[model samples]
Target: MTVNSISFPHPVLGNGDDISDGSISPEISFQISDESIRVDVTSLQTGHPDFDRMIEAGEAVWHLRVQCPRTYMREDFFESGSNKTFHLEGVDFEGLVTIEVSLVTTTTLATYRPQGLHEDYGEEKFRLGRGEVVGIGPRYQFLIDKIYDPLKAPVSSIIRIEEGEDSEGPFTVALDTDLIMIHLSKSDYKEYAGITDRVPTVIHSALVLPVLADAIRQIEDYAESTLWAARLKYLLDIRDIDTEKPLQAAQEILFSPIARTFREVNMRLDKGDD
Candidate 1:
C-alpha cells in the first residue's frame, strides 16, 4: 500500500495538519542498472523546531522502507542523516516497487506537542512509544517492467500460434509465459491461420477469450511466477477487474470480445462480405 493511503494515529509531517514549518519532504531517486538498483535519498528537510530538537537530541530517526510486494521482497533502513544510499538487488522486483519514508521516535515520548496540529486532533497532547512513526513523507512508486523478446510479449502485444501435437484437440493454451501460445491441430492450425486475417474479432472470441480466462485463473495462484503473470496482476488491480469470476474478468479485459465478434460477423454478412 502507498504511504498516503495509510491512516496514522498521530500527527505526521506530510499528512494534514502537522508541523508548523511544513517541511518534512524527502526526495528519493532510483537508479536501475541490470540486476542492481541504487536508491538515493538526496534531500530531506525537517523544517520545524520540535523536529529539529528531536533530531538534535537523538530522540528520532529517519526510517526508509522499500518493498516489492509482488515479488514478496521488503527491506528497511534507518539513519540519523537524511542522505543515504541503499543498494538493492533489482532482479527480485517486478510490477511495482514502493518506498515509504517516516520520522520515527528513537525513544519513548511521555508527552509530545507537535506544533500546528489542528484542534480536531484533541489539542495535540499525545504519548508515543519508541519506534513510533511521528511523521511520514510522500509515497514513491516505480514500475519495474520485465523485459521480453518482442515475439514473447503478452496477448496485449502478440499471440503466438503453433501446430499442436497429436492433431486431436481443437486448441490448447500455453499461457505460462508473457506470450499467449495457442496450439492447434496441424490441419486446424493451417486453416485457422488462413481465416484469422478475415475474422480477427471472431478469432479473438474463440481463442483469445479462453486464454485470458485461463490467465485470470493462473494469476490467482501464480501471479509472481513470470513477468506476464505479474503484469496481468498489475493490470487487473489497476483496472479493478474482479478475478473471482475468471470468464467475466476475461470478457472485461478484452472489452467483450465475444459480443464484438458476433457484431463484426453480422455486419460482414449484412454487407454481403465474407
Candidate 2:
C-alpha cells in the first residue's frame, strides 16, 4: 500500500518571545506502509532549551499508516526530483514528501561561586530546542552591476559601481569615498534587468537620509566627536549639498551651539592661546 497525506494533530512548536522561560510543542504525523515509514518533523522554536529537552527525551513521535491506491500509479506522477505518484484522476501523488526526524537540546546557567562560600549563588536557565524540516527550492543571486552600473551615469561623481572578485558576485556599488555598500539579492537583480529607468527620487531620498533628526541627535550624544565628524563628512560627500533637505538638517547639527563651542575651543588652541 502507498501512503497518502500525513495529518498533524497539533500546531508545530514555536519560539515563544520570552527567552528566559518559554516552551512549545507541535504534533507531527507521518504516512507509512507495512514495508516502509516516511516521517518528517519541524519546530518553530529550534534554539530554546525546552525544545532541546523534548528532543533528548524522545517525547516527539509521528504516527504512521499505509494508504491503498484506488488505481494503478501513472508514469507522469514521478516527476524529476519528486516521489509523488500520479492517480487515475490526474492528481499527483508526488505529494508524498519525505522528512527526516532528529532531536536537539540546550542549557544555559548564570552563577557566581565565591571563594569563601561553600554554596554557589546562581540562576537556573531553560530554553526550547527548535527543529527545522528542510526542503529544496529555487536558487538565485543578485547581479549588483546590472542596476548600479547605470546609476553612475546620473551621479558618477558621487556614486560608482565596482566589480569585485567574481566570487564576491556580479558587482557592487560604492558611494563616494565612504564604504557604504548595498548588495542586491539575485531575484532583485533579475527584476532590475528588465527596467531601463534610473533610480527613483524616493529611493535616492531614502539612500541619502535613512534616519531622522532625533536619531542624529542621539548619535551625536552617544558618539565621540571624531566619530561624529567622520560620519557627517561621509554623508556630505555622497549627498547633493544643495538639493538634499537632510543635508541642511545635518548642517544645522554641525553649526549648532554645542558644536560651535567645541569648534571655538579647538580654534583657540590652534591660535596658540592659553
In terms of TM-score, how similar is model 2 to the real structure? 0.19
Q: What overall lDDT, based on C-alpha atoms, would model 2 receive against the true structure?
A: 0.30
lDDT of 1: 0.75
RMSD to the native, candidate 1? 6.8
Q: What is the C-alpha RMSD of each candidate to the true structure, in Å?
A: 6.8, 22.1
TM-scores for the candidates: 0.59, 0.19
Compose the digit string of candidate 2's lDDT tens values, residues 133-221: 11111111111111222223323322322323443344344332222344444654454444313323323333323332333444323
Q: Please, what is the whole-model Cα lDDT of each candidate in the order they appear?
A: 0.75, 0.30
- Report how far off residue 207 is in candidate 1 (Å): 8.6
Candidate of highest TM-score: 1
Location of the lowest summed lDDT over 10 successive residues in candidate 1: 149-158
